[model samples]
Target chain A: MSQSDYDYLCDFLKERSGLALAPDKEYLVDNRLLPVARRHGRKTVAELIQMLKGPDSGHLKVEVTEAMMNNESYFFRDRVPFDRLGDTVLPDLLRTRALRKKIRIWCAAASTGQEPYSIAMQLDQRAELGGWRVEIAATDISGDAIERAKAGLYSQFEVQRGLPIQMLMQHFEEVAGQWRIVERLRNRVDFQTINLLTDFSRLGQFDVVFLRNVLIYFDRDTKLDVLARVRESLAPDGYLLLGAAETMVGLGDLFKMVPETRALYRPNVAPKKPELALVPGGARVA
Target chain B: MKRCLIIDDSSVIRKVARRIFEGFGFTISEAADGRQALDACVTEMPEAILLDWNMPVMDGYEFLRALRAMPGGDRPKVVFCTTENDLAHIARAMHAGADEYIMKPFDKEIVEAKLQEVGLI
Candidate 1:
């Protein structure tokens, strides 16, 4: 891709998804947009760039963005956070929010629905949550991902990734060399296409949000902007889970890191001066 | 039989490691992320830990630090099983108290040999 074409693509992506593409990311843009180009009958990446520049290519831009956003995901990804959620966090939240009698969980950027479905399965397994009104809302930037999430079909490779055998047998049915998440578990989660950069007011408030592993693509300003909006949609004392490498330090004062669990964050209801700790690799540990 | 914990984000790697260790008559426990591995280490007390470098919740580097800091001599010998083969990566793994390093796409015999060399078998 030419420098000007790359710059135009970056600008388009930034305006749509709040994702800033650096000059070094040309290879990534080319690799991701190839299929989109082919689908549009364009012979080369250059042709696709020209198509994107034309007035009729607005839909193609959305298609390219969606294709880039479809990330790899599988059931029960990164078991510890789920274990923590099941063992310590969920129990605590249940007890603390007893008066509300309802719990709202949102999985933002829930690619392929693994994270939210896993959460739903965990809640279903817990006999104590029987009486509570649980609403699980899962959203992804790509409509394709949301559709797949709704289908609840997974391949052997995906099933073997992180799913335990017991849970697999219990919550899913084998279908022609694939596993389909059972209707009961699938029904608990509502999947929709929602771009985090866009308005989230329609989604309403959430008690717990899983926004893991998606922030790495954004620049510092976009990260801050996204988190601020998340904070607005979050309930007081709501929990936010981020990827392990991601931190709220140097980003903004919207949240505080929960001790011991590097991935867990809680909204900063009361203003406290930010304290800096030097974690290994010079990454800030809040 | 000795107990082994395989911690990697990739199911393919985990399955391969499980089969390799099971072939050597070792009981295998698996964790897909670093935090789960730490919990399994505490609960199961495996004789050795086979760790991967990159993961989402907690990477292998942080897991190594946490494992080394655990109380008592019960800390198991760790062998770094990762795709990272660069000298800097090796140096970092060693600095984090890794006893041995095994590169990815490992054959069964190579992994068995590494295990035996570390006296895991």
Candidate 2:
């Protein structure tokens, strides 16, 4: 792939999803999208690009983007955030919301259902949450991944990664060698196909949000815009978790890292400033 | 030290598993087959046994059944670490008294997660 082609592809992805393809990602584009190109019957990547440019190629375009956007994730991808969630975050939220006995958790970029399902299992494990309603709302940029997330089925190897054996037995039932999350827990989450670049007010406010690992795909400006929109829907006292590798340190303090915690943040209350205004619903969907 | 038994035919697997289990604060023991594993159990029972499916003398299934039949055998957590993915095999293992299953080609995190599942760590 040429530099121009990579640039064009990056622009294309940015317009559809808020994903920014860095210039150094030509190798990644080659490795991840070559199979998509082959499936589309293109002899070479150049031909694939040309076909993507053809009239009424919207379907092909969506397929190609979805192919490239299938990021890798596992149940409780990192242990610390989840530990904090079960140990501190949820407990505090439960106490604060005890009057209403309601809590809403949003898992942005909930790939393959692992993250949201993991959240559900944790909430159910707490006997204190017996009568409380803890709603987990999960969304992904890809529709196919959202459907898979809704199904809550996982392969043997997939279940093995980061999933505790007892939790697997308690929350999932094995069917035809693959594990399926129990209906009781699987039904607790509401899955949606949402582009982070779009209006999320329709989803309403969240008491807790897990926006882990998805910010890296976007450029700096896009990250700021997404965080602003997240703030719109985030409760003032709500907690947010980013991936361990990710931070909001230089993002103008939209999220303030809580003391003695990694990736756990509280929304930094800032006066509405005109300079930070990012147009909500920035990109048009294909 | 938390005692753990690594029962497998492959020396490499045993060595690798020993390292992971040891890192989790376990004093490791190895057994070449189910027969040897049973003899080792008789000598000193471990808190957890990471058993592989296929072996020369006695396979994991037979060993699980025999182990379950032993006095106080059910006390230890038996986790099947194998490449097998068939439903029948899993059902057989569960019926034979296996506590959990972790697929092969795993690393330290996965091993630690499994031990955490069985409440060992």
Candidate 3:
């Protein structure tokens, strides 16, 4: 691919999906976009780029974006995050939102649906979450990804990556070499195709937003822009989670980093003092 | 025979580590979590421990801290075998008193070599 062609493709993608493809990513673009070109019956990536620049290339852009965005995902990606979410974060959210009687969660960039499904599984395990009105909205930029997430089918290798065998047995049924996530877990999550760079007001507000592992691809400006949008969608007392390596530092003042957990961020909510009172006789209240 | 305890939440990982130790003539004990591993460390008093970083009840870092707090002659040499391969994770593990750090999907030879270096074999 020529430098100009690469630049054209990058600019197109940046405008459409907010993915700022660097110059050095030519090889990656060639490898990933070639199949997209072939799928659209184009002879070369340059031709595909030309088509993308043309007035009537809406369908082609969608295909290219979908191709670029579909990522490898399993029942659980990193076990530690899920553990922290289940043990610490979810419980805190439940307690904090007790009076509200409802909770909204959004899994941003929910590739193949594993992350939201895993959360749903964890919530189901607690039994108490069932009492609350919980809505899980999972979105990915790729329509293909959203479709796959909806299917809830996973291969053996994919299932084994992070999911424990007990969870596998409990929540999935084996069909040949693949495992299908049970209907109960599938029903809990609402999956849609949503680009983070674009306006997400349609998603409404979320008490917890998981935008993990998807920000590394963007440049600083895009990260900041996406973070702002995410901040807007987040409820006042909401939590925003990123990948282990990603952080909100220097990028935005919309979130405060939660201590100890590397990627956890909280919206600008006033720190509530612990409920404590002194007894009339000078004893402390528990 | 040298007694070694393998502390990990993953059954497959423990099974693999058990096979590796069994090949080296060490008797193996197992614990599913950090709390169980601490209890087993006192009761069984294994010579060495192959610990995983993440687990339920308690994590390896907490287990290591408790093991260090125990009276002398009971604390076992520990090697962290986990999927956390980042340099920061390695530094944290070493700082927490892990004798060696081994990443998961570990080669059997490397496991044996680390065990030999630590005088566990």
Candidate 4:
């Protein structure tokens, strides 16, 4: 592909999806878009780009953008975030949401559903959550990924990655040669196709938002924009988990890190003043 | 170094496992069947055992049971490796004290991930 075509594709993806592909990623564009080109009977990626620029090419644009999305994810990925959910987040929510008896979690960029399923299994196993209504709203930028996540089917290789045997036995049933998430567990997660660059206010407020490992791919401006939007979607006490390598430094004070945890943050709430308490001997303690 | 015993009747599987485990910095040992694996455990218990199902003389399930019955057998994390994908086989292995199981035709990534799941790596 020529420089002009590559630049056009980059601009197109950036404008639509907030995916800022670098100049060095021309080869990556060619690699990801080649299958799309072949599927549409176009000889080369350049020709596919030409068709993208033409009139009445909306579906082709969707296909091309979906193909370019990075959907790499696995069960209980990185482990620590899930551990924090069980040890810290859930317990806190159980107390804070006791009156409501309802909790909502959003896994922004939940690729192929592993993260949400992991969370569902964690919630299901907790007998304490009995009679409480829990909803995991999992969304990804790619419709193809959302469909696969909805099916809850996984290959042998996919199931093996970071999934414990006990959880596997409890939550998944062997289907033909592959494994599938049990329907009850699968039903807990509501999957949707959502682009971060678009309006997601309709997703409503979430108690815990997992936008992990997705921001590193975007440019600086897009990162700030996405974080700002995510901040709006989060509840006051809601937790936000990012990739281990991602941070909120210079992205604004929309979030503050939870001490001693990796990539775990909570919406920035001002510290409350300590109230004075009367002591037995008439001494006041603050 | 972390120790791992690779038990399989097939020399090919053993060799592949050795290369993969060695890459993960494991001191590797080999066994042909369940009986051999039990004997090796008695001699020197490894931190991890990668046992194949349907081996000659003794299968993985038998070895797991026998190993768990031994004095220091419960110390090692046992992972059953096999072509059996059915829930029955998996349930049997887990019932016999196997920490995890992986299907056949696995690669280094699968082995590494399974080992990680069992806290072996």
Candidate 5:
């Protein structure tokens, strides 16, 4: 709660999660970390900060960071982006990847699993994707988030947010008064604990990347670094979708914003000449 | 193809919803309010009904109770669609023999997902 304590908390969060917390956000620190601090038997947040400064605060640090990191998610949180993903992005990717018969999607900061599962549900609906191999790699910085994402269970309140009742009935089963996503959907995504501040190239290339809504916490430089690293994993012809409020403009030049669209982007590569399609009569069509 | 009756006062919402269901190859019908929806149902019972909560002639709750009492009404799967998502309303709708529920401002995926949920598609 003191100036130095606030400084330590802010610096540590920025260092670990790239979240630039303002000095005046003591109330946020109090609200988020107080319960976490109490669990460690610390009398006050100051005591928790003191313990966090200790060399042997590995578990305590994980607890603190996980507590601070928001893990809110639901099936299809935002409708427009998913509609775009289903309507345009996947159709284009399916055509491009037809030769390979394989598609890889990475959902960065896949809190709890709804985003990735939402993607899986969309893919499942695509009759065009029959016999193709699809891999959705879902990752978050919090181990707790990854575990919960893996579990595929949601409370009534969690499912209430933007989740269709049909999805709840078809894809989920009531288990002990909570909804559990069916095994078929639960198996579609591979969950991992990934810290975006570090390298993520080892996760391999993705035909489509969803980094929605997680960028607001980062400072300008961190956003650039993160986008650059994300670019390393995105296929040259692949697409990246950001949150409605988040934009690639002035953040980095690894991508160019698509016009008249919400947040769809393609990699910033040299423009290729248009390939005309021939009509049945052999006339070239633009 | 299985038929689906979309009950909502808004023409735009009905059109938007019709496209989502028709994608699954279902025959689609629309009604402006609960009264017209009953008339549509009396002629031919649809395999599924996407009922909206608020309307001018009759609201969804009253229609649902009336429909369940009608001859052969229980055969069709009914999904209550509404913007009022409070737990009390949800409980009330479910209590009135509504099989499922979807919120307003839905698109293709949400519609298809609900249909799939009820095993209608």
Candidate 6:
């Protein structure tokens, strides 16, 4: 690929998906776009870039953007957050939302549904959540990913990654030599194709939002913009989970880190005093 | 050192699992079948056990039951590593007191993840 075409793709991806491709990442562009070029009957990535620059490249642009976007995912990708979901996060939400008897969770960049499905399985294990309405809204920028996630099917290799065998046996059934997540768990998640760069207010307020691992691609401004929008879509007491390496530093005052937690944050509101519990004939304790 | 017993009929799998677990600082021991594994356990109980389902002398389920019945046997974190992918086999393994399970043809990453899940690494 030529310098000019590389520059064009870098800018295009940045504008469309908030993917800040560095100048030195021309090799990444070639590696990802070459298969797209072949699929489009183009001789080389240069030809694909030329077509991408054409007047009627609207659909082609979407394809290119998605091809460049990383879709890496696995069951319970990071174990800590899931553990926290059961031990602390969900327990807190259960107490806070007991009267409402409803909990909404958004997997903002739910590549192929593992994160959301993992969350669903975790929620199922919580006996206290019985009779409560739970909605897991999982969305990805790639329609292909959303469709695959909706199918709930996975390869042998995919199922083995970070998935506990008990959960796999309990939740997924073998279908045509591949593992398919059971219909009950599949129906728990509502998958959709959504771009984080665009407005997602239609997703409504969520008690918890998992915006993990996808923010590393964005520049400073895009991160700030997306974080602000996420803050808007979250409930006042809702929690936002970011990637292990990602943070809210220098992104302005949209969120504050939840005390004694990593990569977990709540809205940037004034701290609420802890509720003290009192026992009969005993002193109050926090 | 954190001791782990690798029980598999296949020497290749045992070697591979040894290499991976060794890198994670586990002192590894090998056993060919479930009977041998149970005897090894009676001598000195390991902190963790990587068990295989279909062995010639004694299968994983029988061995698991025997081990759990023995004193200090329930202390080891038993992880079943086998080719058996069906629900019945998996459910039985868990029911027999196996802490975790892994499908066969596991690589370093999968082993690492499973070990991490069981808190070995």
Using DockQ as the measure, which candidate wins?
A: 4
C-alpha root-mean-square deviation, candidate 3: 14.5
Worst 10 residues of 5 chain A by lDDT: A277-286
Q: Which consecutive 10 residues in model 6 chain A have the weakest lDDT in total? A: A277-286
Off by over 4 Å in 4: A270-286
- Please report, in order, the local distance difference test score of every candidate based on alpha carbons: 0.79, 0.84, 0.78, 0.88, 0.83, 0.87
Question: For residues B12-79, could you state the per-residue lDDT of candidate 1 as single tens digits?
Answer: 98998899889988889999999999888777688888999999899999999998888732468788
- Give the Cα-based TM-score of candidate 3 against the true structure: 0.67
Against the native complex, each candidate's DockQ, computed on alpha carbons, is 0.03, 0.44, 0.03, 0.83, 0.11, 0.60
Model 1's CAPRI class is incorrect
Candidate 4: fnat, from 0 to 1?
A: 0.92
Tell me each candidate's TM-score: 0.69, 0.84, 0.67, 0.94, 0.72, 0.91
Where does candidate 3 stray beyond 4 Å? A269-286, B1-121
Which runs in model 6 stand beyond 4 Å of their true positions?
Answer: A270-286
Candidate 6, position B107, lDDT: 85
Per-residue CA lDDT of model 3 for A160-272, tens digit only, reads 55564446657887665467899988998999898776678788999889999888877666676677668778988788988777876666466888778768888765432
Looking at candidate 3, what is the lDDT of residue A31?
86
The window of 10 residues in a row where model 2 chain A has the poorest summed lDDT is A277-286
TM-score of structure candidate 4: 0.94
Q: Model 2 over residues A1-286: C-alpha lDDT tens digits?
A: 7777777788888877877877788888888778878998876677777888889898888787898895588887887889989888987997899999999999988988899999898878889998888899999988889989988999877889888666776788878868899999889999999888887789999999999999898876778778877877899989999999998866767778999999999888883432343432363211
DockQ of 5: 0.11
Lowest-sum lDDT 10-residue window in model 2 chain B: B85-94
lDDT of 6 by residue, B1-121 (tens): 9999999999999998999899999999999999999999999999999999999999888999999999998899999999987778889999999999888877888888888888888
The reply for model 2, stretches above 4 Å from the true place, is A271-286, B1-4, B9-29, B41-48, B53-78, B82-100, B103-112, B115-121
Model 4 interface CAPRI class: high
Give the candidate order by descending TM-score: 4, 6, 2, 5, 1, 3
